[model samples]
Target: MGSQSEVMHCYEQIAPLTERMLVLARAKQWGELPRLEGQCSSMVERLKDIEPLSTLDEAQSARKYVLLGRISANSSEIVGMIMPQLSKLVGVMKSLDRQRSLHKAYGQPDDAYLP
Candidate 1:
């Protein structure tokens, strides 16, 4: 809360390009990703010297709650921000679960995942 503007400014500077990198990653254009990665890495390096984020001290917690309220109130951007990673993790977990179930049903873990 001490410098909410600073926090938001940093996020603003990096989020667009990070999102672009995510898009290029999804499209599998690995060759074109370096520029975005460099931008993100540069922003991160700038940020690294900052102190860690605060724990939920009352005033800071209240600020965070307000921020979360704004995020939750606006469904589209929050979901867009979160869903791609969520979907990928879900897909990987489901695949692993299916492999597990197959192993349970058929008795061999290796065979369950094998062609």
Candidate 2:
């Protein structure tokens, strides 16, 4: 509530996280899965103003879309404050994806990553 500048800066930070989350969903590393899970309560809170999110996979791109919708709708209420947590979550998820993608790309059929 301090200023619009403050809010927009927060939005900037969250924007990249949304992209990173998209990749995480694609990678499906799923190591720090708690970060995605914990947001359910926050999403529940936003439901009063934001549209109800679909029953999409919680740790996937659809979930990220729901978050972007909420963030766009309630930019003022949420942006500045959620950064640290979301950044940390996305950071770890990215790290996990880097390794997970490699393990997957080079994986043998018996490695359990194959269909």
Each model's lDDT comes to: 0.59, 0.50
Which stretches of model 1 miss by more than 4 angstroms? 1-4, 51-115
Top TM-score hit: 1
Q: Which residue segments of model 2 deviate by more than 4 Å? A: 36-115
lDDT of 2: 0.50
The candidate 1 region of ten consecutive residues with least summed lDDT is: 47-56
lDDT of 2 by residue, 1-115 (tens): 3333333334344554444444454455445434743453444444433333233244544555665775565443344435655798999999867767887778733345434
Query: What's the true lDDT of residue 100 in model 1?
Result: 84
Per residue, candidate 1 scores C-alpha lDDT tens digits across 6-63 of: 5544445566665566566566555666786677567667545442552335764566
lDDT of 2 at 26: 47
